[model samples]
Target: MRISATVAAVSGALVLSAFAVPAAQAAGSDAGSYRADVAKIREAAHAASGKAALSGSTVASPAADEPYALNVTFSNVKVHSGKPIVVGAAAHVSVPVTYTLTHGADVDITASDFLTGPYIYKGTYAQPTNMLFGEDAGTCTVTSATTASCKATIDIYPGDGDLSNVDAGAWKAGAEAIALNGQDPTSTTFDITKVGLADQGGFASPNVTRLSKLTVNAAPEPVKKGKTITVTGKLTRANWDANNYTGYSTQPVKLQFRKKNATTYTTIKTIKTTSTGALKTTVKATVDGYFRYSFAGTPTTAPINATGDYVDVK
Candidate 1:
C-alpha cells in the first residue's frame, strides 16, 4: 500500500489509480496491487450505491449493494509512538506504525493477495483532503489463530507533493484490509463479489508539523561589565512547496541566557524576528554567561533552540 504518488480524485472520490501497479504484475506478493484493487472495488461500490466515496476504514458485508466485508478489526494502533511527525524540506520521512489485527479464524490473512496496514489522513474519513500510507506492505506475526501483531512504515516525501504547508497540524489514523481471493481485478468482467474489504477509522489522532531551525550568535566574546552586548540570529522552517528551508518571519522568539558554568538557561526578553526572519538585540553585559535564542513553536512548526554562544565578561 505505498503512497509515493499524490492521491487524486475521480468523481469527487479520492482514488489510488496513479500509483496502482499494472495488472500484469498483480500475480506476485505485490501487496500494492491488491490494495489498489481494493480501492477500485470501493469506488465501484460507492458508485453503485450512489453514495459519496467511503474511506478506507469503511466496513461492509455482502449485501444488496456492497462487497463482502472481511470479519476483521484493527486495534492497538500506534504511530511513531504517539509523537508528532516533524518533516523537513526535500527529505523523505519514514514513520513506523504498529497495530494488532484480529480476525475470524476462517480469514486467511497470510494469503498472497491479502494485505492490511494503517494510514493517516486529514479531513473526514469518508472524504479525505489528503492521505498517506506505508511504502511497503505490513509484516505480521501471528500471535494467535485469530490475532496478529503487525508493523509497517509510512514514507513521506515533502518535496513530492505528498504534503504542503497547509497540511501541518492534527491528522486522524485508520486501518484497512483487503482480500482479493484470487480474483483478477484488472479484467473487464471482474467480479467485485469475491473480494473482501474492511476499514476502521478514528482509532487515534497524530500531529504533523514542519521542522523548524534556529541559530544565534552573541558578539563581543570578551566584554567589560556594564557595556552593551549584541545578539543576532535567524529563524527558519521547512517550506514544503519549495523543498527548502525558508525564513519564518514575524514570529515571536525568545532570548535566553545561562550564566557561565550554569546548567540552566533563563529567558532574558521576548523578541520577534524581522521581515526576513533575522534577529538582533542588545543587552548590557552584566556577567560571564552564554546567550541563545529559543522558539516555542506553533501549531504548524516544531520548537527549536539555538546553541548557546559563550561570552567572557571581564
Candidate 2:
C-alpha cells in the first residue's frame, strides 16, 4: 500500500511539471516582445529630437500677411538596424517655422499644419491611397484659431527607404533588417493671407525659395447696424459662406452693421445677431448705415460649409 501511494505522488508531480514548461516558454516570449517595443519607442523619440535642429532660415520663413510654404527637405535616411522595421515604425520630428508679422495688429491670420494629403485645418482634404504616416500640427494658427508665429511639432514615420544596403542574410524569414518604402521626405505648407483685420498691404513675401508663391487678401467689409448682405469686397475667396467667419471664442451676440457704398467696412455698434440676426453697439465711426457686408477672395484652401444670417439693427 505504501509503495502504491508513493508512485501516485510521483505521477502527479510529473504531470504538473509538464504544464509548467509551456508557461515558462510563453513568459520568455513575452519578455522578448517587451524589449522590442521599448527599442522601437526609443528610436522614434531620437528621430524627433534630430528634427528639432535646423538653421533659423530653414524652419520659419514667411512674414505676416504673406503666402508661403515651408519646404523641408530630408537627406536620404538609412536605418542602421539591420532588423526589419514594420510599416508603422514611426519617428516624431518637429520642424521650426518662422513668421514675422509686419502688421500683427491689423490682419487676422489663418494657417494649418499638414504633411502628406488632406488635413483638418483650412478644411479636410481627401487622404490619398498612398498617404505617408506623418503629420504637422505643433504650432498651428488658422482663421478659426489664430496665434503668433511659434514652433510646431510634427511626426514623421516611414512609408519607405532602401533595403539593398542590408545583408541579404538579414532579410531571412526570421531575421531583422531595414526595409524601406522610398517615398518623398514630405512637405508642410503655411499660407498666410490677410483676412478680416485692418490692412496696410505691404506684406513681404516669406523667405522661402519656391516655384510659385502668391498672396490674396480679403477686402474689408462694410459696417452696418443690422442686416444680412452679401459681403463683396477684396480678393476672390473661393469659399464665401457666413460659416467662414471663424472667431470661435468671441462674444457671439453683438450689434453688427455695414455702410452704403463703402470700399471697406467696420462695426457700426454692438448688437447681438439673434437666430434672426439682431444686435447693438456704441462706436464713433458711422458710415451711411447700410448695415451689412461680406467678403470676396480666392481660397487656395476651403473652410467648412456654412451660411451667413441677417440680423435686426435695433
Candidate 3:
C-alpha cells in the first residue's frame, strides 16, 4: 500500500513521497499496515541501554563548504500508539524525520542528487550510538523551487545492546546527513544540534512481577484450650538470574488467623523470614481455628498467601 504524508509548508502544500520501506526494515509499521520490525526496535531500545559507552563528549558538525547544504526536522516521535516508552514492554517506537536539503546557488542538482536517509543515533550526545532503521531507506520529493522534502523512519530497539542498559531517564536523539554516491557517504551534512529526544513524552522501566511461594503448617492437630500451638512456614520467590525459585530471606510476613465460622481473618503478629525463608511462631489455642502466612511481596515479585492450616481445640 502507498503510505504518504502532506507537510504544510510556509510557501504552499508539500506532498511527501510514498514510504517504500518494508516492515522488516522500517522502525515501525506503516499506518494501517501490520508489521513487527518497529515493535522490535522499541523493545531493544528500552530493554537495558546496554553496557555500551557512557562518555561525556561531543562532535562538531560538518562544514558548510561541502558540495551541498541541508537541514532536517523530526515529528511523530513516540512508542506504541504514541504511548510513553516503558522499558521491557516489547513494543515498537516510531521516529519519523524529514530532511530539506538546500543546494548552493551555483550548484545545479536534480531530484536524484539527495541520498536515502539521515544518520540516526540514540543515547546521550556524549555517548550516542548508530542506528540502522532499514535498508535502502528514505524517500525525497521536490517541494519548492530549490528545496526537497525527504522522510524516513528511525526505528528503535530498547532491549538490544544498543539500548538495553542505559540509565532510566531522558535520552537524546540525533540525525546527520552526508552526500552519497555509488559507494561514498553523503557530503551534505545536517545535524540536530539541540536537545532532540525521541522520547519527549517520558521514559521508565516497567515493573516486573515474578512467581512467589508461601507455606504454612501447625504441629499437634488436636490441642487443649490454653495450649501453645506452633505455626511454621517458608516463603520463596523466583530468582531470575538463578533461573529457579529460592528462599526470600530476612523479609517481613504476617501471621494471620481466623476462628471457625469466622468470615474474616485477622493479623495476629508480624514475623520475619530467616535466611531460608522459614517462619515460626506460637499462639495459645482458645477455639478451633485456621492459621496461615501472608506475604506482601517486593518490587520484583507478587504477593501470595499460604493455604490455611486448621487445628482443633479440646
Top model number, lDDT: 1
TM-score of 1: 0.82
- By TM-score, the better pick of 1 and 2 is 1
- TM-score per candidate, in order? 0.82, 0.18, 0.43
Query: How many clashes does each candidate structure show, in the order listed?
Result: 2, 56, 33
RMSD to native, candidate 2: 27.3
Better of 1 and 2 by lDDT: 1
lDDT by residue (tens digit), candidate 3, 197-305: 1211112212324557899998678999998999999998755444456788999999999999998889999999999989999999889989999998765556888
User: Which of 1 and 3 is ahead in lDDT?
Assistant: 1
- Stretches of candidate 2 off by over 4 Å are 1-254, 272-289, 293-314
Query: In what order do the candidates fall by lDDT, top score first?
Result: 1, 3, 2
Evaluated at residue 114, the lDDT of candidate 1 is: 81
In candidate 1, what are the lDDT values of residues 10-114, reduced to their tens digit? 323333222344343345645556446656765655544443333343324323534576788899999999988999997889999999999998799999878
Which candidate tops TM-score? 1
- The lDDT, on a scale of 0 to 1, for candidate 1 is 0.77
**Residue 122 miss distance in model 2 (angstroms):** 20
RMSD of each: 5.5, 27.3, 13.3
Q: lDDT values of the candidates?
A: 0.77, 0.21, 0.48
lDDT accuracy of residue 222 in candidate 1: 93
Task: Give the CA lDDT, 0 to 100, for residue 140 in model 3.
Answer: 63
Pick by TM-score: 1 or 3, better one: 1
